[model samples]
Target: MRVDIWSDIVCPWCYIGKARFERALASFEHADEVEVEFHSFQLDPSAPEEPEPLLSFLADRYGMSTDQARETDAGAGANAEGEGLAYTSARKNANTFDAHRLLHLARERGRQREAVDTLFRANFGEGADVFGREALVGLAEKAGLDADEARRVLEEGRYADHVKADVEQARALGATGVPFFVIDERYGVSGAQPADVFTRVLEKAWEERD
Candidate 1:
């Protein structure tokens, strides 16, 4: 069984949804047989590489005030906390293309899952500036990737096409948002659905797989 997840590191729901899906996978009878991979998806492709206040970005994008955006983040924070994940309000938002490129490198190194987890934690949990290059290299090192290689990849723009291809694939699959899950290319689950939903789908996919 293969589970390909399309999610952005900066997306709160993607962080929460990953936890939920893992919870389901943890308890699945065929857990050891499941091969899970994370694919890159950018919620804001045109976002600046330099960091900006996430709340302000949200406020401008949704035509809401900063206070309203904070309230919305609070709700998302609460949901993340429900899943035993940390969520801080002072998060930054920016272009994640380089991060996605690094993910492809991590995948080749067999540390893709760890890299994804580390990036999510750095952005949403520790409130680290994941948008910055040095910060990203630190996070990659924390995920057990070689720091020098990670830095080189970022500098040289390695795996850039892989990142773009992943985004294009997401579009071809009709995914208009992050946290999209495609199970065996058979079932598509969107957003932060509950763990039971993931469990049921996992089981169904397992049963129906040829």
Candidate 2:
């Protein structure tokens, strides 16, 4: 079985949802037979390249006060801690197009999953500036991708088409949000559902596959 996950690195729910799904996948009976792929989806395509405080962005975008935005982020952070993952709200928000491009390069090198995890950690855990080119190369290196090649990919704008294609495909699949999971191309699960829900879906997909 193959699972294609569409998500953005900056999305807190995607970070939390990934942890939940992995908990299910790890305990799955046929875990070794499953193939998982990560697809890119930019939550804010028109977000500024220059970084800004996430709390301010959330406040301005949603008509909430900065304090209210922090409260909302705190709620999400609490959820992440429940999943045993670190969540920091003191991060900057910026365009993730280059980060997604770097991930495609990681995919070519058989390190996409690792890269995805690393990016999430950089964004939400350590509160690193993941949107910059230098930061991405460093994160890619941490994910076991070749540092020089990763730099070259980012510098030359490689895998841009692949990133754009992922977004287009997600649209074709009727995905309007991040963390959308398609299991065996037959089951679509939206949102950060509970672990039991994912386990049941995986089992059903496994049983029903030809």
Candidate 3:
């Protein structure tokens, strides 16, 4: 079974969804046979190249007060805690285009999942500057990838097309949100669902394999 997940790095729910999906996979009888791929999807492609206060960006984007946005962040943080993710509020917003390109680079080295988890933790847990080249190279190294290769990939603007293709594929698949899970490209699960839901989907996909 293959599961392709479309999600953004800075997305709160996507982190929670990843934990839940991991839990499901852990208990799956066929876990060893399952293949999971994480795809690129930018929640804000037009977001500023410079980092900005997360609270301010949320407030402006949703037309809500800063307090409301903070409250929302707190809510997401609490949910993340339930899954041991320890998510923190966004202190800075970053353009994830380069991050997505780095993801493709990591995928090429067969460390895509590790890169995904590392990037999520760095951005959401540690509030690292994911948009910066230095930070990305560090994250890539942490994921067991070559730091120099990662730097070259970012420098040469490599894998940018792969990121674009993933985004386009998501749009063509009628997805309008992050954390969208496509099971064998046959079933779609949206949002951060419970582990049971993913487990059920896994079973169903296993039964209907072609």
In terms of lDDT, which candidate is strongest? Answer: 2
Scored against the true structure, residue 188 in model 2 reaches a CA lDDT of: 93
Clash totals for all models, in order?
0, 0, 0
Badly placed stretches (over 4 Å) of model 2 are none
Sliding window of 10 residues with minimal summed lDDT for model 1: 126-135
| Model 3 residue 115 distance off true place after TM-score fit, in angstroms | 0.6
**Model 1 TM-score, all chains together:** 0.98
Query: Order of candidates by TM-score, top first?
Result: 2, 1, 3
Model with the higher lDDT, candidate 1 or 3 = 1
Q: For model 1, how does the per-residue alpha-carbon lDDT over 3-36 read when each residue is reduced to its tens digit? A: 9999999999999999999999999999999999
lDDT of each: 0.93, 0.94, 0.91
Q: Using TM-score as the measure, name the better of candidate 1 and candidate 3.
A: 1
Among residues 3 or more apart in sequence or in different chains, the pairs in candidate 2 whose N, CA or C atoms overlap within 3 Å are none
Taking all chains together, each candidate's TM-score versus the true structure is 0.98, 0.98, 0.97
Ordered from best to worst lDDT, the candidate numbers read 2, 1, 3
TM-score of 2: 0.98
Which runs in model 1 stand beyond 4 Å of their true positions? none
